[model samples]
Target: MTPRGVLGADELNNIAVFKAVSPSVVNITALGLERDFFSLNVQQVPQGTGTGFVWDTQGHVVTNFHVIQGASGARVTLADQSSYKAELVGAFPDRDIAVLKIPAPVAKFKPVTVGTSRDLQVGQKVYAIGNPFGLDQTLTTGIVSALNREIESVTHRTIKGAIQTDAAINPGNSGGPLLDSAGRLIGVNTAIYSPSGASAGIGFAIPVDEVNRIVPRLIRDGRMVRPSLGVTGGGPEINRALGLPKGVALVRVQRNGPAAKAGLKAFSRGDGGILAGDVITAVDGEPVETQDDMLTALERLQPGDSCTLSVWRSGATRKLTVTLAESDD
Candidate 1:
């Protein structure tokens, strides 16, 4: 039996989620300077207003990199209306994530309940807690509109496995938490596929799984550690200009590196004019068409792992087993 003059169970659950997660969400303001166009004067400007959340009790806050980019300073406002000066710790523009530290008491911070995004289903109810258009602590409800969507980062790299939602993400909603029905953090709202710069029911978030893998590394190393192949290759433009086939040709191989140890040669000028060196065609039996593909394939492995590479040399194909080394460059 339903209670008289009371809300339904779904409505009650939504309200409870907003109350539980709003405390963890924060409003960020970035200050900068801009020169006036008409007069030769500089003025202080509010460059950005975005959202973030408490990652832990040690005063670390996580937000999008573009939120604080180019700002001279920033401030964080909490749910209790307490504001504090925030210091930029580190930023990963390739993943669109940044971390900030505030000198606030432990008692004032409430870390959000972290959740996994590995098994999220489409149409599951989700809520976005952000400060859209500078309206602090606003709550919007929607569903997981899609999954495994790819979005481009500020660094021009493709961020795979992005979560697409219809959760009314607006300008000030960047870096805010996208919570599940149970109020657990699943994704960080990053971009929207809207032409009008408003909520067109199409928004994207960085999956918490990638965030889980990268944030700790950022907190410790202050940068992302991506695996490399120890060889310098050219992009597609250079490949086309050289009239080479669709593959990453080694232009330079590091001395005593993995490729050098495996007898991989680099392009050189010899008696027979330009000597074409080894052009990498595949890795671990998977076809690599361009330099980006090679890098993406190498990212799946770590240092000290052995893999077989297929190379095209001297009008023939050859295989070489190379031991991966930690990249210093």
Candidate 2:
């Protein structure tokens, strides 16, 4: 049984699922303008291309932040060759998801079924349908190599949890759906762990649970709302490098900050004897792999939303619920 390509049994099976969802996947093109001078010249421009799925019949298409960034005009093209101009409905840059609206006929927009990220097990069957390099509605299959994986944020200031897969995701694949075996959308393809700018068997996606939680808020507001503790960490990476568990050692506090107001204590060099600090290993049961993980979790909560912190102190882990205060930023 010689074949022209190295197609495996799993890949063949996944092709069926991909075929079923391909029509629902769309290629997103963001158009904008760059003026030549002060109130002078203007020309229509194309920003970038990313993949997205038909979120609903009302024309909500979900995508990534870096994709439609600075977009003045946008368009979504379906597999059936139908095209529609898109309007930026909403965006949450923190979660890296954007919702675009297209005025297409109701029949053309077929929404994909959403799945839970909490249910994904490592090595489970997963597939990706994307517009890789403008190749329109292409599919690649692989297993979920890991869950709750973190990828560097667009700002390089934080990291976001993504569903890691071995699926062949490429440059233009950002914002495409990462599907489970039952053809359900578990994640949105966001980035890759490749250095060669190609699919190196490591692709990442924004978890559907995160998406499900943030999209509604972004739709209501123009941005994702996050609660703040208003305490700065005391250069904790040095301690972290010396074989200690990682997290900020609370050094300074704002008198009116949520952390201070909630009675969350800190450690000072003069008063140090293994002082009690909230050694944050996780937030809301999601593991904090890095500082970015904490930031991403923080991005989901709003001021006045009470939250419980998983803290470690003196070799024991305890939960401390802290009432959130608004971030001045």
Candidate 3:
């Protein structure tokens, strides 16, 4: 074979990026408990494998919650092939993000450089390093195919503002880091649009902006403490049956809660029939047509923060300022 000439600028950049970022990527092995039918003995067995990256020198590792879902425990294998038993720190399954901690020394870690996803273009270059099919440390390159895509989480909640790429994300690639050309983490590879359970050149990643927002809270509280309005609303079907406006129709409002204190009335059954209630059409000028939209908007604010809600009632609309409260959900 003829000797290859000096590499091009792009090739050199790819090489540099792979070398710089590969060390931050790690392989995750999920372990589950299984009972032997004959002896009835419970044993820890390998459930699955995925990818993750170092979040900090304190041994915090971030990965998809689904990657370790239902597993009894997990193990993290660093770039040096050193494995350590990991402890679950926290998880926000609504966004498919989880944090694990390893007891490895601080000197053994190299956290990936974090980048923002708010300004990603549709055609910017992106790179993915993951353990596809359990083969660790594989690198694939592609571009941002789309932006602002949405995907469902394990909790059946909508994860908005996802980043779509053609970066060859395979099954084992879940929870891996999706980096930009500068070797900065832009997203965390989560899912793919494939029928055969392989890379179909259509992959989705949780945007790093969301990750950066949720990870810290998870680390601090062990879960995402979403802000709530203390009002139970009807779903789309119920809203449609009631002929309500394009917003959440309050079905029940907790007494003395934020919504109730704000004078938001709930639907009631009168002598004639079901009476109309206040339907929230917007939050602080942001239109919310569904419950998920309302939740998404509220997630942007903190508990105790005051916001204006556009409430629609019989033939009239009014704005109500209500204080948000922390939710257990």
Candidate 4:
């Protein structure tokens, strides 16, 4: 028989999680200068407060891209309300992760433990610890609702493989840690999917795998380099006749783009004179149903990826293998 007042394995675990991670979670407050012509003077505006976690012992802190955005001055407030002035180290607006440098001495820093996002499963219990609305180290709980979400980033680019949760994340939770049941930081809470400008019980986080891929590169190169095919083509049906197969009309190709390098021909006769069009049926064994699918398939590619393209030309099917090139532009 179970004891009358004893706690189970879950309750004790929650308390342990709270104790383990709350200290590493921090509150980031940004202050900005506003120029007011009415007063003919500049005033400091309390920009906002967001959450970030300690990324390393060297005092590098990580948070959302929108957190320290446009920040002219900033500070980090710890659990005890102890504050430290922070400097911008680097930022990745595409991935929504920004690294900040705090001047806090080594003795004052407690690096948070990093966790992998690859192992997360839907319906798993998770928790959020953050300084929502300037409140320090508050805790909220929920479960992983979904995975691998493609969301519009603050930079207007699509960020792939994000974590989705029903965890009540709000305005101040950006850059905070989305922890697993064991108190490990699995995802960095970044955005909320809401129409009312408030938490509708839906939140999104940047997957740690993305952080792992980007953070080091940002630290070294100060930017993320993405490989691209450098070809643009697509329109409604290419205005074909009633019975003919639909095709995408290419207007132009980059001087040395992948398609150009592959020596693929572009239309240039009557109704196609040098008009430069290629009817793409497939790419690297993947069917291209729409423009977005092609873009998405090419999105995560790195340099040196070999791609075979299936094109319909002169009423014939042919395949061409092209080795992708790096785009510095």
Candidate 1 lDDT tens digits, 35-125: 9999969876777799999999999899999899889888898888888989888888888999999999999999999999999999999
Q: lDDT winner among the candidates?
A: 3
CA lDDT of every candidate? 0.87, 0.78, 0.93, 0.78
Question: What's the lDDT for candidate 2?
Answer: 0.78
lDDT, candidate 3, 136-240, per-residue tens: 599999999999999999999999999999989998999999999999999999999989989999999999999999899889988888898998888888778
List, residue by residue over 1-329, the lDDT tens digit for candidate 4. Answer: 96588788888888899888988889999889999979869876679989998877888888897988887878888776788888777787867888888877787677777789998999999998888655557888899999998888776767777899998898898999999998878889988878986889889998887787777766666665555566665554653532224544444567778888877655445654434356666777777645555655564566679877777765777888877777665
Deviation of model 3 at 218, angstroms: 0.4
In the range 13-38, model 2's lDDT, one tens digit per residue, is 68778777888899988888888787
RMSD of 3: 1.7
After superposition, candidate 1 runs with Cα above 4 Å error: 1-4, 34-45, 133-135, 236-247, 266-289, 293-329
Model 3: residues >4 Å from true position, as ranges?
36-41, 133-135
Query: By TM-score, highest first, what's the ranking?
Result: 3, 1, 4, 2
Better of 2 and 3 by TM-score: 3
Candidate 4 clashing pairs, residues 3+ apart or interchain: 268-272, 268-273, 268-274, 269-272, 269-273
The RMSD of every model to the true structure, in order and in angstroms, is 4.0, 4.7, 1.7, 4.2
TM-score of 2: 0.79
